[model samples]
Target: MIRTKSFLSLLLLTALLSLQLTTRAEDGYRLWQRYDQLPSKNHLKQYRQSLGEVMVQGSSPTLTVVKEELQTALGGLLGQPVTITENSRKKEILVAGTPASSALIKGLNLEADLQKVGKEGYVLVSKKAGGKKYTVIAANTDLGVLYGSFHLLRLLQTQQDISNLQVSNSPKVQHRILNHWDNLDRTVERGYAGFSLWDWHKLPQYIDQRYLDYARANASIGINGTVLTNVNANSLVLTPDYLRKVKALADTFRPYGIRVYLTARFSSPIEIGKLKTADPLNPEVIAWWKNKVDEIYRYIPDFGGFLVKANSEGQPGPQNYNRSHADGANLLAQALAPKGGIVMWRAFVYDNNVPEDRAKQAYTEFKPLDGTFKQNVMVQVKNGAIDFQPREPFHPLFGAMPKTPLMMEFQITQEYLGQGTNLAYLAPMFKETLAADTYANGKGSTVAKVIDGSLHNYSLTGMAGVSNIGNDRNWTSHPFGQANWYAFGRLAWDHSLTSEEIAEEWIKMTFSHDPGFVAQVKNMMMGSRETVVNYMTPLGLHHIMGWDHHYGPGPWIKDKPRADWTSVYYHRATEKGIGFDRTKTGSNALAQYAPDIQAQWGNPATCPEEFLLWFHHLPWDYKTKSGRTLWNELCYRYSGGVDSVRAMQKTWNTQQGKVDKERFKQVQMLLTMQEQDAKMWRDACLLYFQTFSKRPIPQELEKPANTLEYYMSLDPKFVPGI
Candidate 1:
């Protein structure tokens, strides 16, 4: 009897190991769609009870994808193959589709709920008919049903209670997109992961499996559009050969409800059309653009539109022909109008020769041009007027352009937030700018409301996130960087989501379902953004990173060809004080804002200290909110940032067995590198700035082990993402 029992045990052990090998989701390639078995058998029982015989009652490409995805997801989560059923009367039957496609759902009264959710939105409800209980995912369109399927899968993946689910959701903005700054040669600008995902050399004929998976991940998160080329426009992409490649990608993404857009070179008429002048108002340029747009629609019937970066950083534009920005935007808008497309005109324009405050330049140029742009043109404004700094006040353009639709442009690449290696959860940072009171109309005018079109009542709405994706196996270089991508998509769909809630969901889906592990990691992620800001650019300090690559601390950077190109120009640290004064007494950049903003932010006492130094050059003896001198406060913030990173390391170290061994060691090593980098930021900045203040490092805090000359002499070579 004992020998027979031993044989049975050995058979069971071997079978379990084989099953685990094929089903492991250790690599982040699966991302948050991981459908690994429920951690708790009790939870599994609950989910299985709520989700029984699957019946996606539709027949189309999108509905086909929905069926396959749900099959895979449900099979993985339940540790069993899910069977398709034809019966709607079966208790716990999961019926999903548009009411027109599913007779079971048509019999139910969901028109009011379905009407509330627009064409892209969905409704999930648990209903009863006689004695049979049914769970239905109903939507107005096929894409909405697909989105509903993903949302239901997410609820299961995150272990949410779905027994009594009654949810209706719609996207807050019309266009949620990813702007890939990828070039034709597979090079990505400001991309920290690896090379570009678009294999241009082998495209149009050889469709990579990664493309379908990319569309799957995006569509799962409610992202509807993608800009394929770099904002530094490439004319070759408009050529016939490249349009074929764009069409291949467009076809692959169409079923997933993703539309592809390209960047239009303002000088395309000269570069590809064989014309002498590429003026926006010129008849030759106008005809060339119209013909080109018509050709694009032929290749991709659902081609989204164009994103232009003209007259910014030496790019060609209407300014080259002595025309206005509106002229440049309207030219393309007219061409795309018939195709139901729009032009996303970037507001990142600046000139080194123009003697203007770098932070005030966008508002200065765009505020005057309100209502000049066509209805199909959207002014894409970055979150801040200057750049994607660690911390910046909301861009003044958000509230300034009420007549014309203003779209929010946020950078998710982490160029200034420690590039690739640092673990910076950016959802909090994104929420900060969105929730800021722009005061464009009155007190409660938020940047979120402006972009969502509720405050401004604009006809069009959208938000663009400069993508952090690349060919890296994990998409983003850091494992945690995936959270930023997920968070951006979630918030782009609904800005009302809390940072904490997003972090919790991401943590649960990405790392572990263990209660203790989830809570600890979620807390660590919640504080990561502030921790980065503290060590890198504490207390309103902006654009102090090293020149060119923007990697480490460089408070002493000066003597560049352009004033704004040097850290010294922004920080203005001197013998008596440190900071840039943008008030009436200084550059008067504060006058660009509404009077109420001018009154609150202009005064040092009333101004939020997060933006205190951004608008004022304060003295070393100035008292801070903590009753410490300005110098002491700087020391405190810098030290606190370093300490916070250490805490993050400790928290992650304790979660050793909670996740896969590969990602566990990966995060562990990354955290160690981050801690070292955080120390470097604290030491380098304090040492460099101490020369101006002539103040001793606070006694209770750690002091720099090296001199300022040591930091200045050290040069890092071959940095990624130039």
Candidate 2:
């Protein structure tokens, strides 16, 4: 009898081990949609009871996807297959559909609630009707029902109480899109995650599973559109062969309510159409574009319109023909207008010949042509006037353009924020820019309101994120990089959501529900962006990274092709001081802003220390608010950044047992690289800047192990994402 009992126990142990092996590994491919089995049996029981029967009343492609997603999520979360029935007399019945598609939902008299939530909005309610408990996800359109389904799953995933739920939600911006800087050759510009997600070579024939997954992920976060190609476009993408490939992607994404867009190469008419000139005013050029756009719509009926990057960094544009930006945008806008498409004209233009401040060029060029753009044209403005730097003042054109709709373009890829290896939660950086008071109208005028069309009173609005997605298994190379993508979608859906709230939701869904682990990681992520700015470009210093690749420190970078392209041009370091002077006595770029903003940032004493050096050339001996000399403060800030990274490492170390071993170790290794890189940045920058400061490194701070010559001499070869 004893021997028999021992054998039974061994068999039970073997069964448990086999079950563990069969469960999915935490590889991060599922992202925040991991509907892992509930840990608490009591909670599972409650959810199973509440979600007893699902009666979906729509059969459209989008609603079909919604039903499948619901089944998958419910089965995984509750550890039981949910019953889908045509007629459910069950007390707790989950019903989902649009008012037009469902008689039951239409009869429920939810017109007031549905009216409050727009066409793309959803209303989720739990009510008792005639002694029967019912949970309803109702919307005015099929797309809204899809969004509502995701929200319902999110409530369960985040362990929110849904018993008395009455949720009404809508995206603040009309167009929430991801701009993939993916090339035809499968390389991604400024992308740190692996190769491009779209396999253009094998596309239109072999549909990779990643395509569907990518669409699902975007749809879950209320992203409605995707720009398939890079803004620095290739004319070949518009060719017949590539249009077929784009069509395949569009077909796959259509069911998820995601419309695919392309980057319109301004020279496509000359390159592909064999036109004499690609001028916007040229009749042949105009006809060529119109025919090309018509061909694209033939393949992709719901195609989103063009994202044009012209006359910047040598790309062709109307400027080449001595025409205004409005002329170029209007050319494309006229073609897409008939098909209900819109043009996203980039405002990232700067000219070496013009000889204006690089920071002031976009505002100068765009502010003049504000009301000239066509109704369907949106001037896509980068978050900052310059490139996606660590920290920058909100783009001057955000509030300056009231007549033209301006869309916010944020970079989700970590171009300057340590690329693939560092952990930098960018929601804080994004929030900082959105919350900045533009003062275009009055005190409360903010960048968020401007982009959302509330302040400007525009009918069309959009928020575009330069995508960080790639072929990497985890989507983003750095594990925490996924949070950046998630945060951008959440902010695009609702600009009012706090960074901390988004971080918490992401942490819970992506990693763990353990309060201790969540708290520690949240603290680490919240402070990461500031830490990067402190080490890289503290005191408003910007654009000092490696010359071409922008990999690391290069404060001594000078003698480039253009004066504005060099770090010395922006920093202006000399025996007197270090920093660019953009004041009235200097570049006078502050004059672009409203008088209130100019007054706030004009004086060095009143200017936020964070932006002091950005606008003023300060002396090394200048007194700082920290009661330290400018030189000493610089030393402290750089060192403090390194110290903060070490703190992140320490915090992550405590989460070993709480987090999955695979992701925890991956983050650990990345954190180690981040620490080394931080030190490299600190040592190389301070050593180079010491030449201009002529001041000793504060005795309290660590000294550089390598000389300035050694730091400058180092040339890293084959840097990724160049």
Candidate 3:
């Protein structure tokens, strides 16, 4: 009998090992939709008791998705079958509804309040109804209920209390979206993750479970919308066949409060519509857009809006017709307004006709047309005036436009900040911009306040992040990159969340709830962004990337198609000195801000050290707080960034067994890559700058082991996204 028992145990062990191996082989493409069984814990038992049964009050493809998602997640967490019953019991019952479906919900004052909430807004409450204890998730529409269901599941999965829950949260902005710069051919522009998630050829018919999982993850974090195609707009996504495919994704995402948005090809009237011109003001062009909007609405009634990138990077727009950006935006806004959609016109534009100071161009163009834009139009501005750098001051446009609603555009993809190789947590980056005091109206005019439309009484407001998501096992190629997407959604919903809080929450959800592990990882995540900025573009240095790929270092790049496109334009690293001169002596761009801000930033001595080089030109011998000259300070920052990554490696190494083996190993390998990359950045930058400063390597710092020529020769062909 003992021999037989031992053989049975060995057989069971072998079976478990095989299952584990199979699971590990699968990349984390499912993201948080991993419906793996939760550990047997006291919290799981309590949650299961509170959520004994579910009652769904809607029927659609989206509704089916919600029910299946809830069933899968609940089954995994509870380790038991959760029956769905129509009748309410004295015990706890999960109730989901649209305002039209639930009479009890319709009777509540919530119905009037629900009108204020968008179709995607939802409320979760634990209350006694009809003499029975219930956890009810009600929304203005079925999509809202689907979102509520995900919210409830997230709280439960993250080990938050579900009993007596009274959560009524709606997105402050109408369109909280993810802009995927994914090409139809599967190359993602500035995307660090593997390949594009949307396989265009297989899309409409072969609805991958990954699509449903993507919706679940986004809805869990309060993301209400998604823009599927690249902002460098493609005409094909507008075709009837692609629209059908998009409708498939829209159907999958609808119940989860996510509406599918498309990157509008302004020249679609010419390219796709075969018109003579794509002028927004032309009667034919206007009619074409109206018909297109009608076509989209017919397929997906909850279609969010259009994300337009025009007259920037050779893309077509109203400027082609000699009309202003506001003219371009207003035309699209008019087409969509009848269907209750919005037009998010990008504010990132600059060309030879524009002024030399690229940072100030957006403000120069958009601020003048404050009230000119239609009510349904939002000017989407990058966090900084320039592209998403490692560190950037909040865009001046945030405070400048009170009448026109401006949406904050953050890049979740680490375009300039080490791509997917470096484990930089961008929660701090987002928090830095959001918490910045815009001082538009008065003392406390933070960017957050402006974005939520509280400071300005504008009706339309929002936030969008260019997605880093891809066909990776963990969704984001780098595990830490997931935090950026999570942080964007959290901040979009409630811009009040601190970086520390966000890091802690993400660490707990993504890794472990163990306080020791959370604390250690959170510390690394919290400081990671600053470290990258220090190493790469410290003290307001910007846009010094390789010529084409924008990877590693290319501070020596001077000859490109456009002078400004090259790194040399911004760095100004000649024999005399380095750093852009945007002061009274140069572009005088500082004058655009309020006099108080200009006064503060105008002078190098008084200017915040963070933006010192951004505004003022100073001698290399300029004194800093560290008692080192400007040159010395630059070296120290670069060196510090390198050291910080090494320290992060040590911190992560200590977390070996605390996290899942596969994830821990993956992070360890990435950290090794980051350390190597950080060193390369430090060496290449210092070597290049040495030509300008004519200064020896500081005594305390290690000299570059090789020549600048050697560093330059180590060029990587086929740099990921490039």
lDDT of each: 0.91, 0.92, 0.83
**Which candidate wins on lDDT?**
2
lDDT score for candidate 3 against the true structure:
0.83
Q: Write the per-residue lDDT of candidate 1 for residues 519-574, one digit (tens) a residue.
A: 89989999999999999888799999988889988888999888988999898899
Candidate 3 residue lDDT tens string, 1-722: 99999999999999999667534533445555455555548777777776778877667666676678778788877878877655555466787777687665664446655666667778887777566777788888777777778778777756787777877767766668899999999999887778999988897888888887787788878888899999999998898988998999998776676788999988998998999998878999999989998999998897888999989979998889999998888888898998889989999988855647888888888888999999999999999988898888788898899899989999999999899888888888888899888778888888988898989987988899999998877788898888888888888887887888877777766666677898888999988988898888888898987877888888888877777787888888766677888878998888777777888888888888889888867788889778999999999999999999999999999997676677888888999998888888899999999888999878989777789998888778888876
| Per-candidate TM-score against the hidden true structure | 0.97, 0.98, 0.93
Q: Residue 520 of model 1: what lDDT?
A: 93
Worst 10 residues of 3 by lDDT: 21-30
Ranking by lDDT: 2, 1, 3
Tell me which of candidates 1 and 2 scores higher on TM-score.
Answer: 2
Better TM-score candidate (1, 3) = 1
Which candidate, 2 or 3, has the higher lDDT?
A: 2
lDDT of 2 by residue, 307-387 (tens): 999999999999999999999999999999999999999999998887778999999999999899999999999999889
TM-score of 2: 0.98
lDDT value for model 2:
0.92
**Superposed Cα RMSD, model 3:** 2.9
In model 1, the clashing pairs are none
Backbone clashes per model, in order? 0, 0, 4
When summed lDDT is taken over every stretch of 10 residues in candidate 1, the lowest stretch is 18-27
